[model samples]
Target: MHKEEIVLLHLTLFHIKRLFEQAGIANGHFKLYDSLDVQPVHIHKSKADHKKAILMLCKGITEVFKETPPDEVLRNPKMKELLEVVG
Candidate 1:
């Protein structure tokens, strides 16, 4: 994807992240999906876990938003896989 496309997706992901936080999902992992365990049994989760968890969270949220209409974001199909990674 192009730089502009990435930026747009990032903006959408950020909005959904704020919404999730407001909804009471505070693990500090939503910003680092692949790094976070995203489980309640993990008592020794590290910063790396948190990072991966956030990435996964954002990727999922971005996909869901892409399928739905945009209220505060521009949904698009071309950006779904762009963010579904551990990077």
Candidate 2:
């Protein structure tokens, strides 16, 4: 991944973490493993359902951009392209 993309991903994850904390969801963690080279971003939540954890993270992401139109984020070229594959 390019430096800018990595930066954006980190920023997004940071906001997600904050949102999770605000929602009282403890131990919500995200990690990016560049070495994996596939599905590098992982969300961790102890004693939680994997699918539920992902939903919570996605909710957190939505809350983070609550003031902004979500389309604006998906419109990001790099994000758009990435989402096309992973989303």
Candidate 3:
């Protein structure tokens, strides 16, 4: 994907993460992401940095889903694969 595309994806996922947090559905799953101090709006950041942030966000999102409904999370093989690859 192009840099702009990745940034857009990063923005979307960042919003999803914030929504989960606001709804009290997310725990400290985003610790790694938070520690990175790189927001999606930071276009000055390198592509690789954004990529790392994206993975951390995905990991956190998967964890949040798993925490709320373990059975449902297991049903999605791809999500599990992503969690394994990202975590």
Best by TM-score: 3
Highest lDDT: give the candidate number.
3
Per-candidate TM-scores read 0.37, 0.32, 0.78
Report the Cα lDDT for candidate 1.
0.47
Measured on C-alpha atoms, candidate 3 has an lDDT of 0.83
For model 2, name the residue pairs that clash. Answer: none
10 residues in a row with least lDDT, candidate 1? 74-83
Expressed as tens digits, the lDDT of each residue in 1-87 for candidate 1 is 543444444445555665544543333535444344443234355445434444676676765456554552322332333234322
lDDT string for model 2 (1-87, tens) is 554454445446555454444444323233322222222133332223333344445555555467445566556565556555645
Clashes of 2: 0
lDDT of 3 by residue, 16-67 (tens): 7876665556779999999999898999999999999999999998988777
Ranking by TM-score: 3, 1, 2
Question: Which should have the higher lDDT, number 2 or number 3?
Answer: 3
TM-score of 2: 0.32
How big is the positional error of residue 25 in model 2, measured in Å on the Cα after superposition?
0.5
The parts of candidate 2 lying over 4 Å away from their true place are 28-87
